[model samples]
Target: MTQIDRTMSLVRRAVDERISQAIAERRDEWSDAGPAAAELLDAAADLLGGGKRMRAVLAAIALSATADSARREDVLSGRACAGLGAALELYQASALIHDDVIDGALTRRGLPAAHRRFATAHRGSHWLGDAEAHGRSAAILLGDLLLSAAGSELGAALAQCPQGTRAAGRAAFDAMAEEVALGQYLDVRTESLPLPDEGADHAAAGRAMEEAALAVVRRKSARYSVMHPLLIGALLGGLPPHGEGARRLAELGEATGIAFQLRDDELGVFGDPARTGKPAGDDLREGKRTVLLALAWQRCDAGGRAILRRVLANTRADPAEIAAAAAIIEECGARAAHEERIDEHAERARRALEALITAEAGLSRSATADLASVISLLTDRSA
Candidate 1:
């Protein structure tokens, strides 16, 4: 098997084991608490059971690529890489839990969202007086618990690393967490505020909003999703701090991370509800100020502008209005523009790979190919 394949396999196994352990621990802690605890455990398990494992895979690949062949076997066998992968995966879980709460989403990964599921079960059994309130409370606590667990795992992983390597990895991980939170703040702020004045040229205001949205996407979704995890792995593998390989990874990471967020935005607008586990045009429903929306709003004239304002103002717009909004977005050529951006980002990522191959003599050709393949797979995914 290729190095990347081996790394991904190992990382998946590690994440699965950690998730199982977490569930067992949670169950044990609340064993006497009755069904609520059990429900929470089940909810967490459902979320953990299936995911792309992209972040964990990236971590493993980064570490494996930098380690010497002889030491690579030892690192993979020693549990250090697994610990790191598991920690990163847990962090992802925490983020998802919180994201569901923020979005008020009802489902994820084809299952009822953690909060909704817990709330419904509580209400059904007459266990809680206020089902919705109880659900939200439970989800918040559960998300916090998961975040703490992730920190513990990450600490263990760092302790296992060789002396000098831990510092860099920890620093990168910390920055990633902080940046994502800030980005989320920006996103929430944008939604809570009104759009800029229509009198000030609707297109100009829309363009400004798109810029703001992209900034958030870069910090919140891109950095933490792919770049930081990969960098952490590279650091743990004891690669030189500023070597050609390290530089290449950074360049490639930025490109792939941006592309990943763009794809998610596309999915938000157009993905199947059944497959995406989200409502159709959910971003529109949320009034999320994405590039797609910005472009569409910009291109509309007075009538189109009026239609957009009315649909967006309604918290419970009908399907026809939603469809009209989507149509206006498409008619404005925003969809094509966003797609073109995705392609541009993908090309940049590929260029980074090419730069790595050209500049670094020590990097294995197979490793480079594997990295490129994984990037392509992620960037080109439909769901």
Candidate 2:
């Protein structure tokens, strides 16, 4: 197998093992609950079952690239690195559980959301007060549980690392968790704020909102998703803090994260339900004030502006309204603008990788190429 393929295989195996271990641990702890606990376990298992494993893949590759070849004698010896990836995945699950509650989403990955599933089970079992409240409350607790589990798991993984490498990994994991929460807060706050008024200083409001959204994206998605994971891997691999390879990885990660988020935004708006596992135009319905939306609003004319407002105001927008919103966005050139932004980020990421290879003779060209390929795949993905 090619290096990328081999790396991905290792990552997948590591993730599977971690998830399986997580399930077994939870099962052992909750065994007395029997079938109900089994159901919850199943829910938890389902939650962790499938994903792109992008963060995990990045972590493994980053460690492999920077670690001394002698140290990486075995793939599983990189458990600390894989643990970082598992932490990210668990963090994603926690965020999604809470997000489903906040957004009132019914399904995720073609299954009822955690809250809904818990609530339904609670109702059937007759062990609760209000079923809905029970479900929401339970989901909240479960999210917390998952987050805690992620941390504990990360600690376990880090424990296997040499003493010199453990601190750096811990620092990265801490920053990732903290930053993602702050970003999520910004996003929830943005939803409540009114859009810019007609005759209002459109430029000011649009810029302000866009900046806020961008900041949120940076913290909530980009930094945690790509930058920190890669950083942790490099650190665990014994790359010095100011090493050329480490610095370059940071730059590459930032650009990759931006592109990754932009792709998510695009999927939110344009992705097919079958592929994306989200309803068409879900972002619009959720009134997510994305950078793309802000750009569209800024460029639209008066009539187009009115159409945008109408779409946003409708709580239950039909397909026609969604299409109209999309059309206005396209007509105003926002789609092209968004695409340009994606390209810009992708180029910056490539440049960062180039700089790394140039500055660090120890940096493997094959590893750098693998990262570049991953970035290309992310930027080009449709869903």
The local lDDT score (0 to 100) that residue 256 gets in candidate 2 is 88
What is candidate 1's TM-score against the reference? 0.92
- Which one wins on TM-score? 2
lDDT of 2 by residue, 283-374 (tens): 88888888888888778887887887777635688999898888998888988989998999999999998888888636566577678888
Number of the top candidate by lDDT?
2
lDDT of 1 by residue, 1-383 (tens): 86667766767877688668867987998899998678767877788888878888788777767556666655654577778877888888888888888878777787888889879978888873899988888998878877888888889888988889998888889998898899888888887888767688776788888888889888888878878887898888776768887788888888899888888888877787767777777777777778777777777777777777777636587888888887877787888888888889889999988997787635545456667987887788778
Once fitted onto the true fold, the runs of candidate 1 whose alpha carbons sit more than 4 angstroms away are: 1-7, 29-36, 68-78, 242-244, 359-362
Model 2 bad stretches (over 4 Å): 67-73, 76-78, 123-128, 313-315
Candidate 2 weakest lDDT stretch, 10 residues: 68-77
| All candidates: CA RMSD (Å) | 2.4, 2.2
Pairs clashing in candidate 2? none
